[model samples]
Target: MVSVGDDAPDFTAPLADGDVGSFTLSEHLEEAPIVLAFFPAAFTGTCTTEMCTFRDQMANFEDVGATVYGISIDTPFTLNEFREQNELNFGLLSDTNREVIDAYDISMDFADLGVRNVAKRAVFVVDGSGTVTYTWVSDDPGVEPDYDEVAEAADAASE
Candidate 1:
């Protein structure tokens, strides 16, 4: 996993931004800090709750000049539906190929559940300089990150 103070891995992926736009990590870092929330899948209970938490606290993140994005192995089409259904204001990035997932070393195999290469529940805060300022990887997929800590990291990165 990428640690704090390490340069965030750069990647561009299709974003479920209403119109199928793309998000480049480095490009976004040039503008503001970024909060990347990697989840296993869309429409799952835990994923839904975690994303909604981010949505509800978006203002706090925005106040710190940070952009929030949820990354998953799901396709953009499915993610767009999920975003609309949940009224998510942030972007849901499609890491369908699992390239970014692998790069971040957050992939999980669930052979017993018949799933593979899904992302572990994780959060990463990247500053304007593309350095990872914060990271949280949940051992259980059902667990969520600390929202307050994430917000504080974003606030600190903005300064």
Candidate 2:
């Protein structure tokens, strides 16, 4: 697993916001501190609440010029709908290929649901230099990260 001070693994994936676009992590690096929030799936109860909480707390991230992206195994179309429904200001990255999850070492399996290669609930704050500044990962999908803690990490990364 990636730790603080480790170089954040860069990857490119589909961006699902209002439009179907592509996002390259390396391209966004150096522009601002980046928050990569990886969730198991979209439209689920815990995922919805977690994402909505981030949506509501977006100003804290924006104040420090940090960019946030939620990642999941869902396709761009599903993520676009999820974004619109939740009114999420940040873009959602579609990791249908599971490359990002694999690279970050946050892949989880939901054997109960028969789902495989889902992203475990994890958050990574990457500074402008593309080095990880903070990380929070939970094996239990029901658990969410501390928003204030993540905001502080992003603020520190901005400096």
Candidate 3:
């Protein structure tokens, strides 16, 4: 699993930010602190709430010049709908192949639902230099990250 102080793995994937585009981690390096919020799936109860919370707190992230993106195994098409429906302010990255999840070592299997290799609910705060400054991963998909702590970490990382 990716830990704090480790180099954040770089990957390029489809981004759903009102328009379909490509997001490369390396390209965004040195711009600002980046928040990568990985969730199992979109349009679900916990995922919706978590994403909406981030949307609500986007001003805090913006105040610190931090960029946030939500990631999931859902397709960009589905992610676009999810973003619009939830009024998410940040982009959603599509990891349809589970490459990002595997790279971050946050892959999980929802065997009860026959879903496999989905991203575990994880949050990684990466600074401008591509080093992880904070990380939160939950084995239980229902759990959400502490928004205040994440915001503080991003604020500190910006310095």
Candidate 4:
């Protein structure tokens, strides 16, 4: 994973914007605060609840002037289905290639972890300056982040 003081590694990947499209971290976060919440995959129970919580609290983040988006190894097609099914209001980035997740060093170890090329669940709060201020990682797959901590930190950092 990128470090606390290091620049947040930027990458462009396919996203579910109506259909499968491309989006860049630097571009999306150019002039706004960005929150990239990484999950393991789509349609999984814990992942769904975690993302849905973000959906419900999205306005809070926006109200504090931060743009929130979710990132995962799932394809845009699956992401589209997830968004439509769950009514997610933000972009669900497809890191199927694992480029972005790999850059963040959040990709799971296939041999030891038993899941080949899955992303570790994480949350990163990047300020408008493209610096990551807060980073949260779940110890295991089933755990959900404390969104309140991240949200509050993002709000404070954005200011």
Candidate 5:
């Protein structure tokens, strides 16, 4: 996991949110806290649970003035289907090229373990200044993050 105060690599990736057309990261970076919830893949067990949890708690996060983003290595087509099926209310960014993951140094070349070139499941809380204030990467995908803790971290950092 990245330490607090590290600069989150600035990169623009394709995003599709509901009917919203494809856009870049800059479109959503202003005026609110950005929570990049990086999951391993779309439609997987832990990933689904984690994303749905974020979807459920989105309003609460917005009430506190935070914006959450769901990012994964899934193709845009898979991401679109997952978002529509789950009724996700946030931008699902496609890092299919793994550029963002590589830039952030979160990419794992786990070919030895039979899974290759997938990013680790992680959450990065980036402030308006684009500095990382909080980061949590699940060593094992089964262990989802405690949403409340992430919210608290965002709340505390925004103050």
Candidate 6:
């Protein structure tokens, strides 16, 4: 996994912003700090709870001058549906090819679940300079990151 102080891997992928645009991490990094919440899939119970938590606390993230994104291996189409269904306020990114997932070392094999190359539950805070400031990778798929700690990391990154 990419550790704290390591430069965040640059990636450009389709965004679930209900448009034909793509999101480039390096480009966004040039502007402000970023909070990346990587989930295994969209619409799952844990994923929904985690995303809604981010949505509910989006103002805090904005107050700290940070951009928030929820990423998954789901396609943009599916993510668009999930976003609309959940009323998510932030962008959901599609890492369908798992390129970014692999680069971040968050991929897991869910053979029992009949899925492969899915991302593990993880969170990463990247400063404006593109250095990873904080990371949390859950060993259990059902576990969620500490939202308070993630917000604190984002605040620290802004500073």
Local distance difference test, each candidate: 0.93, 0.95, 0.94, 0.86, 0.81, 0.92
* lDDT ranking from best candidate downward: 2, 3, 1, 6, 4, 5
State every prediction's TM-score relative to the real structure. Answer: 0.97, 0.98, 0.98, 0.93, 0.90, 0.97
Pairs that clash in candidate 3: none
The candidate maximizing lDDT is 2
TM-score of 3: 0.98
- For model 3, the stretches where C-alpha displacement exceeds 4 angstroms are none
Of candidate 5, the 10-residue stretch with the lowest lDDT total is 19-28
What C-alpha root-mean-square deviation, in Å, does candidate 6 show against the real structure? 0.9
The backbone clash count of each candidate, in order, is 0, 0, 0, 0, 0, 0
Candidate 6: the clashing residue pairs are none
Candidate 3's residue-wise lDDT over 27-125, tens digit each? 987666999999988999999999999999999999999999999999999999999998888999999999999999999998988889999999999
lDDT of each residue in 30-68, candidate 2, tens digit only: 666999999999999999999999999999999999999
Badly placed stretches (over 4 Å) of model 6 are: none
Stretches of candidate 1 off by over 4 Å are none
In angstroms, how far off is 77's CA in candidate 1? Answer: 0.4
Please state the error at residue 101 of candidate 4 in Å. Answer: 1.1
Give per-residue CA lDDT, model 1, range 13-129, as digits (tens): 999978699988988876568899999999999999999999999999989888999999999999999999999999999999999999899999878999999999999999888
What TM-score would you give candidate 4 relative to the actual structure? 0.93
Q: Estimate the overall C-alpha local distance difference test score of candidate 1.
A: 0.93
- In Å, residue 137's CA in model 3 sits off its true spot by 0.3
Residue-level lDDT tens digits of model 6 in 1-159: 899999999999999976647999988885567999999999899999999999999988889988889999999999999999999998889999999999999998889988998999999999988999999998799999999899999999999
Q: After superposition, how far is residue 47 of candidate 2 from its true place, in Å?
A: 0.3
